[model samples]
Target: MRREVPLAITFITGFLLIIGFFIPHDPIGGLQSMFLQWYAIIAGFTMVLGLMTLTRIHTRRIVKRTQGFGYSVILIGAMLGTLVVGFYSGIKYKGLFELGTPFMWYYNNILVPLSATMFSLLAFFIASAAYRAFRARTIEATLLLIAGVLVMIGRVPVGNLIWNKLPIIAEWIMNIPQLAAKRGILIGVALGMIATSLRIILGIERTYLK
Candidate 1:
């Protein structure tokens, strides 16, 4: 009964959305907006569920004294601290996310800096991956290495001093071959998404029921 109900809902919702896309009339067209509002409400509950799940997992790790438990403690502490501040600010000032509110202050000062630091650390990993990829083992790798070096050099002022045409060549490489490859990838992704959506709509993709 549970599975059947959800599958029926999914089928009806997907069919209506498809209909609304093609035939934008009063009865069917309004269903899309109403469904989107329902989606937002459902998403809020799912977010709360996700937060509860995260806290539960981290609390278990801390209780078990697992490796890196200190990190879990810090994570839980920061999450709770942010949540409390956000709720308090929302009730007190009637705006949790206002520019000068405590929530935004925590977001701008603590969260943004932490995010920047994480990304800065990720640069070293990217450089390591690039080093392996740029090895001149094959013709394609050699071409890639050369193009990468040229692109890097052309982006700098020193490259202009060395050769004025370096930037022009770099621009050609990026605009011509790179852009074509990127567009092909995007088209492939769009096709894949359409296929997946169709599969779900047709009830062939029932993994979501699990």
Candidate 2:
């Protein structure tokens, strides 16, 4: 019954949404909004459940004195601190989680800086990957390497100083080849999604039941 009920709901909801897209009648449209609202409420509860799960896992790690448990301690402490401040400010004090509040202050000063540092590290790793991948071993690889270099240079002011036409060439490459590649990828993704949706609607994709 547990498996059957979820599958039944998936099939019905999938078809209703599909049919609603084509029909656009009042009842179907209203049902879509109602379902979306229900989804939002469910999502909120899921977030709380997720937070509890995180806390449980980290607490277990801390209790067991696992390797790098210090990081888990920091993570749990930060999460609990944020949650407490957010609830206290918003619920008890009738203040908001807005810019001037402690919640936003921690979010902006601590979280944003940490996130920016992570992204900066990511950019360094991306550059390393590009260097390895763009080795001019083949004709295609050479062309790709040249295009990447041109784009990188064109984004900065020195490329214009080096050669005025470099920016124009870079823009052409992006607008023509890059745009075409993106559209092709998008079309493939759309077709794949349609096939997967059909599988779910027909109960062939029952992995979700687990």
Candidate 3:
């Protein structure tokens, strides 16, 4: 009964959401569009669940003096702080209009910088990883190495000056190999999703809610 109820709710909720996208005139559509605001209200009301869960887990760790418990404290503190600031922004801002003067400060400065830093980190990681992967090891590896370098160089002005053929190499990589591989992956993923969806619809899969 416990498991069944959650599964039923999930199934119904998902169908309604999907249908709402197709039927803009329906009440389901209206409700779906309004769901974000409704969610914030419900989330605010239900925050006690999160607080209790965090307290239960962390309190146990703190009591036991467990390893990395201090990090947990910092993590929880950051989460709570972000939630408080975001909520206050919504409230003090008053429904997407007229005055969130104070909260906008945090949004613009803190959130923007953090987002920029995250993106910069990802770019750095990609460059470093690509450098390590693309070496003249084997035939396939050499091709990958060559393709990646061409793409990287073609993206900027200096690359075109150094190797006039780099752009053409990048174009072939993008048009043929990369495109074919991406399509194959997308088809496989779609088939997997379809299979999983059918299993859920037919009650063949029951582990989803868990």
Candidate 4:
């Protein structure tokens, strides 16, 4: 009974949202707006569920005194602190986000740098992987190796001294092949998404868990 009601609501709301994009009538538009409002409410409730889960898991870890327990405490403390400060300063006081608030400052300074540092650290790992995989033992590997080396050197002045072809090769590698492959993969993904949507609409897939 608990699951059945939610499932019914899910199906009804989802059907409305999909049909809303096509229908032009005022009644259907109103129905779409109502369903969208319901979806927003559901999303708010789900956010609370996430908060509860975070609190539950962190509280357990702190109580058990497990390894890296301090970091977990820091994670929860930072999250709650930011939430409270942002809520009061922005929503309650300004009725909008305060750009100069400490919460915003910490997000811009600490969070952004930390994320970038993590991503930048990948450069070394990528270099190592590329070193192993781009060996010129085979014809395709040799071609790929040449392309990579050219692109790497092209941005530097020494590449011109080595050969004038490096910059042109790099341009083709970056602009032509990269864009073509990316667009092809994106198109395939879009088609797959459409197929998945159709499957869900016809009840062939039951992945939309309540």
User: By the TM-score metric, which is better: model 2 or model 4?
Assistant: 2
In angstroms, the error of model 1 at 131 is 1.3
| lDDT of candidate 1 over 86-126, digit per residue (tens) | 89889888587887888889989998999999999998998
Poorly placed runs, candidate 1 (over 4 Å): none
| Predicted candidate 2 versus true structure: per-residue lDDT over 1-210, tens digit per residue | 988898899988888888788877789987877787898999999999999999999999999999999999999999989888888768855566555777778778998999999889998899999979999999999999999999999878999999999899889989999999999999999999999989999899998777
Give per-residue CA lDDT, model 4, range 68-132, as digits (tens).
99988998998888787767677655544467876677778877999999999999999999989
Residues forming the 10-long window of minimal summed lDDT in candidate 4? 88-97
TM-scores for candidates 1 onward, in order? 0.90, 0.92, 0.68, 0.78
lDDT tens string, model 3, 50-150? 87788789878877889999987876776777678777767767653235454576667877899999999999899889878888889999988877778
Two-way TM-score contest, 2 vs 3, winner: 2
Angstrom error at residue 74, model 1: 1.6
Better of 1 and 2 by lDDT: 1
TM-score preference between candidates 1 and 4, better one: 1
Computed on alpha carbons, the lDDT of every model, listed in order, comes to: 0.91, 0.89, 0.78, 0.82
Position 134, candidate 3: lDDT: 80
Q: For model 4, what is the C-alpha lDDT against the true structure?
A: 0.82
**Model 3, residue 37: what's the lDDT?**
72
Q: What would the TM-score be for candidate 1 when compared with the true structure?
A: 0.90
